[model samples]
Target: MAENHEHGKMDITEQEKTFEGFVKASIWVAGVAIGILVFLAIFNS
Candidate 1:
């Protein structure tokens, strides 16, 4: 286990970017879904 112990030495730029993008996409999708639901509710009466 000592041979693979790289504490605080791993390069994670790509991973960080991917995670940021994923979070942004999730927020956008959730917002769009809520907007669509609201539109339907307000118009389907």
Candidate 2:
């Protein structure tokens, strides 16, 4: 049996963070848009 121990460093850049935030915001915005459309359709019918 052999065992190995190793670790790697990870870092996130500002651009990556901003992009992640943008992705999250867009997802929420899309979800809200869908909900609104559904509400309008049901409300009018």
Candidate 3:
């Protein structure tokens, strides 16, 4: 098999954007989950 190995020649803008979006979404989800847990703990006592 012929191998074409080029370093830093590939377009990664889309991948970077997708990863940024994933990180943002993960942080938001975690914050919301923690907020819900705090609310439940405070009100359920």
If both were scored by lDDT, which would come out higher, candidate 1 or candidate 3?
1
lDDT of 3 by residue, 1-45 (tens): 237858788899999999999999999999999999999999998
lDDT of 2 by residue, 1-45 (tens): 224533433355877999999999999999999999999999998
Please give the clash total of every predicted structure, in order.
0, 0, 0
Clashing residue pairs in candidate 1 are none
Pull out the clashing pairs in model 3: none
**All candidates: TM-score:** 0.88, 0.70, 0.88
lDDT of each: 0.98, 0.85, 0.95
Candidate 2: give the clashing pairs. none
Query: Could you give the C-alpha RMSD of every candidate to the true structure, in order shown?
Result: 1.4, 5.5, 1.4
In Å, residue 42's CA in model 1 sits off its true spot by: 0.2
Off by over 4 Å in 1: 1-4
Candidate 3 local distance difference test against the native:
0.95
- lDDT string for model 1 (1-45, tens) is 799978899899999999999999999999999999999999999
Q: Model 3 misses residue 3 by how many Å? A: 2.9
